[model samples]
Target chain A: MMLLKSESLPIVSEQDIVRARQVARQWAIDLNFKLIDQTKFVTAVSELARNTLIYGRGGFMLLEAVEKDLRKGLRAVFEDRGPGIPDIEEALKDGFSTGNSLGLGLPGAKRLSNEFEIISQPGEGTRVTIARWT
Target chain B: MERIPILRMGDFLLVTIQVDMHDRLAMTLQDDLTRQIVASNSRGVLIDISSLEMIDSFIGRMLSNISLMSNVLAAQTVVVGMQPAVAITLVELGMSMPGVRTALNVEKGMMLLRECLDSDDSEVEDDAS
Candidate 1:
């Protein structure tokens, strides 16, 4: 397994969210992921990117392409310096929402990827890294 | 704020989404659809999402909200032409859009709406202004 070439982009605005999704999709396509897998990854990127902007108040995302035993995957890291989640457990709940949303963002993104991780501090910030295998 | 256009045909309203759905755009669409439904007295609303390949939980909530609002205003909402991948992603997202209706395409959606309106004529008549 190896971490291949990667690209980073700021997630301060709505357009950045779209940019992340597009870049992730292109990478997934280049890696020869299935159409459904591409869509899954793109959707996950969209959700997490939005969370970074709205909840995290702005962040950065890294699109990293990786390989394990010759199998390829795309990894995205969304990091923000905004107010972090106090309760990771509650935030992952399907119907829980703090911002007038469906509360599906975190969990849904988790479902759409093969690997998901989150690190946050109440006063510091939050960072979520997700990876999807091709 | 980008606006998604709403077209009226007889007693039905048609909306074809062709752009990236940012949060602001989704909110705007929800508000616009409500206003259009009220103004046109539309009995059915059709949303074509075949062109939209990606979506998130926020958009999912907005779709559900639109369905709920249309119901309150005496109109039926049908979301049609969802891409297969989008369908799989939505199901995995766990936001099944509980109260919203769906169809494979615009033609089938209109048929479904017509059937619903015909079968529930009395309810439509009683509630619709």
Candidate 2:
């Protein structure tokens, strides 16, 4: 994958979540993603960005436009230096949340993306990367 | 500190969500709507979400919360004008919004609220007899 362009946005406050969604939507539109695809990608960004703020204790989101295998895609990486997850599998389950939310952020975001990846450790931190292709 | 406005219209409260709501704003709207419903003695609440291009679980929960809260305050809530893309995304995100009532647009939502209120009034009258 080759990075064509990229930008980073903070996820310290609730307003940042909305900004993340807007940035994702614009990137999806630029990629010529279908309306539904754009909505799906942006919704995924909202979920992950919130997790980065609430669960991760404030992080930054890295947005990237990339080209891979002759296909264009938008990638977002949310990284936080908070208490990490001990059980990655459990954290990815629907309705499994420790933040008093609906517990759909991780799983829902994974479902909405073409590719999803996560890395976490008990005392370290967590990083989630999601990408959607047009 | 931005807040969504709730307008009172003849026994109903009208809310048009024209901005991309942050979490705090969504919660604030929920609080304001419930308060307005009681203060105005509204029989129904119509929420227009046509301008919202996205509906994450947070906003979905906020809508459901508003509906549930209004019901407790003797007011029926009907969500309206959800974009097709948003509807599709909400469903796929594992949020069916089970107890929340929805309509195609503002006009239909108003009609549905009126019907619901009418039915409730008739039921109350029936119980009184």
Candidate 3:
């Protein structure tokens, strides 16, 4: 079993979201994720990164590789200290969004990954974790 | 989340895409349109993207996917009204949208679709005779 870890530099803009996705793609490829799986992983990361910038103002992303029950996968955790989600349930709804455009950020990220978890509080902040197994 | 109407004119389905189209809901719109084109076996499709402020690689890929999928279902897909900035970004990103037709505006896109449909009908007629 092998474990790989990396931390993203703090980013606060939309362009950084794109850069974060590029970093995530490289990591996925280095870990031998299938092409389609890599695309899914990148898409999920893009959504989260965009959210971090649009909603949280700025944040850091952590990438980790894990092995469990003979299965290997990639996991990402995005942490932001912004105005936390006031309502988690509402945020998870398919069409629920506080931004312009379609409200598919959270739900779409959830749909693209194997596992997704979001923990947030009104005053504290928001943490989003997602995993995709190949 | 605003539900943009799918405008139907003749055999073509026209959809106007707005800004912030990189979001997941926009991707879902692509999926929905693909399904619609397949199930209905439409003759043509024109997606107006004039309102989009930016187009990322993912959204470009989705548009390409829709174009390819529509072709398999015997439909022609055209993308119209791409902002210059969006176009430059797509090119800079080295994004290639194969099998997708692009036009400057909806009017031009409609004209191109008409020509494609006309040629297709002629082919069918020739095959029948």
Each model's TM-score for chain A is 0.98, 0.98, 0.92
Consecutive 10-residue window with the lowest summed lDDT within model 2 chain A:
A22-31
Off by over 4 Å in 2: none
Q: What lDDT does each candidate get?
A: 0.91, 0.94, 0.77
True contacts reproduced, candidate 3: 0.00
Per-candidate TM vs. native? 0.95, 0.98, 0.57
What are the per-residue Cα lDDT tens digits for candidate 1 across B5-94?
A: 999999999999998877788999999999999998999999999899886777888888999999999999999999988888999999
Docking class of 2: high
Tens digits of per-residue lDDT for model 1, A69-122: 889999999999989999999999888879977788999999888999999999
What lDDT does candidate 1 reach at residue B59? 81
Task: Give the poorly placed runs of model 3, Cα more than 4 Å off.
Answer: B1-129
Q: State which candidate has the highest DockQ.
A: 2
lDDT of 2 by residue, B76-121 (tens): 9999999999999999999999999999999999999989978988
C-alpha DockQ of every model = 0.82, 0.93, 0.06
Give interface RMSD for all predictions. 1.0, 0.5, 10.1
Query: Candidate 1: global Cα-lDDT?
Result: 0.91
Highest-TM-score candidate = 2
